[model samples]
Target: MIDTHTHLYSEQFNEDLAEVVERAKSQGVEKFFLPAIDSETHEKMLQLEAAYPNEMFAMMGLHPCSVQPDTWEQELALVKSYLDKRSFCAIGEIGIDLYWDKTTLDIQVQAFEQQIDWAIERDIPIVIHTRESFPETFEVLKRKKHPKLRGILHCFSGTLEDAQTAIDLGFLLGIGGVVTFKNGKIDRFLNEIPLENIVLETDSPYLAPVPHRGKRNESAYTSLVLGKLVDIYQKDFREIEEITTQNALRVFGMK
Candidate 1:
């Protein structure tokens, strides 16, 4: 399985990073896509990817929450510099987030649109982060629709209508541990969308599944997400694994 969006480099795992990766590998999670948060984490992310070259992949972007008025342009420029100098799996973890602070709404929109243009120009997929800004996000994507603008909506928690909108925009719904929550509404929407338009992710060390909820999340919990998918799709484990893995490979351009 592939963890499409994870922050293994986060200080949350500093105490047991090796064991976390080993546990994840033992559970068949062979690949991890690490999303960049800001310049402060760029080097650490690169270090993690270097340490596990075959298993860890990195993406470059300036997360909406990380964008301050003074730092937004510099961060975006740093993203552009990273993209030009190296190859990344996606232009990721970038989108509008009004949940934390509504004051940065305008700046977030500008940054999100700029990153979308960057991805389109480079012919690469993106990993989007949307929280309480689905309407705004959809508005931006709709206005700047491009055939090459394809990606996943990380940790999707939107409505069925929103899911369909993402699908219509050539985007996949990135399902994670949230589906296993007793109150997660994504399960209701999953039944409406085909498994083909879905991809598996852990978003670790963050949203651990069921039994591990509230604890530190890791890629090892990908199986829990997969197990939930099986229950939702009424398909076998192996089949769900194969199809989601294929979907991830297709989006990240991995073999």
Candidate 2:
């Protein structure tokens, strides 16, 4: 299985990073896509990818929450520099986050639009991070729509209507541990949308699945998510595994 979104470089795993990777690998999680947060994390992410070249892929972007007034442009330039040096799986973990601080809303929007343009110009996929800004995100994506534009709405927690809107815009819904939450509505939406447009993720070192909820998340728990999908679709595990894996491969251009 592939963990389409994860932060394996996060300091949260500093104490047991090796064990975490081993545990995840033992569970059949063979690939990990690491999303960049800011310049501070760039080298660490690169090192992690280098250490596990065959297993981890890195993405470049300036996270919305990481957008500071003084450093936004410089950080974006750094993203461009990284892109020029090496190809990334996606231009990602970038979007608006009004939940944390509404003050950075304007800057976040500008940064997100600029990154979207960058992705378009390069003909690469994106990994969007939208939180409490789905309408605003939709507005920006609507204005920037292109035939070649495609990506995933990472960690989607929006309504069914919103999911449909993203789908119409050529984006897939990135399903993760949130679906396993007792009250999470993701299962409801999954039942409505086609599984072909869904991809699996752990968003690890963050949203751990049930039985591990509120603890440090890791790719090893991705099976919990697969189990939830099975329950929601009432389908076989092999089918859920095959379809989601294929969806991830197609989005990330993996073989």
Q: Candidate 2 at residue 146, lDDT?
A: 99
C-alpha lDDT of all candidate models, in order:
0.92, 0.92
lDDT for model 2 comes to 0.92
Which ten-residue region of model 2 has the weakest summed lDDT? 182-191
Off by over 4 Å in 2: none
Q: Measured by C-alpha RMSD in angstroms, how accurate is candidate 2?
A: 0.9
Off by over 4 Å in 1: none
1-255 per-residue lDDT for model 2 (tens digits): 889999999999999999999999898888999999999999999999999999999999999999989999899999989988988989999999999999989999999999999898888899999999999999999999998789999998889999999999999999899999978777776788889989889999888889899999999988888999999989998898899989998988875
TM-scores, all candidates, are 0.98, 0.98
Error of 1 at 12 (Å): 1.0
Candidate 1 structure quality by residue, lDDT tens digits, 114-216: 9999999999998999999999999999998999999999999889999999999999999999999989888876877988899889999888899999998
The RMSD of every model to the true structure, in order and in angstroms, is: 0.9, 0.9
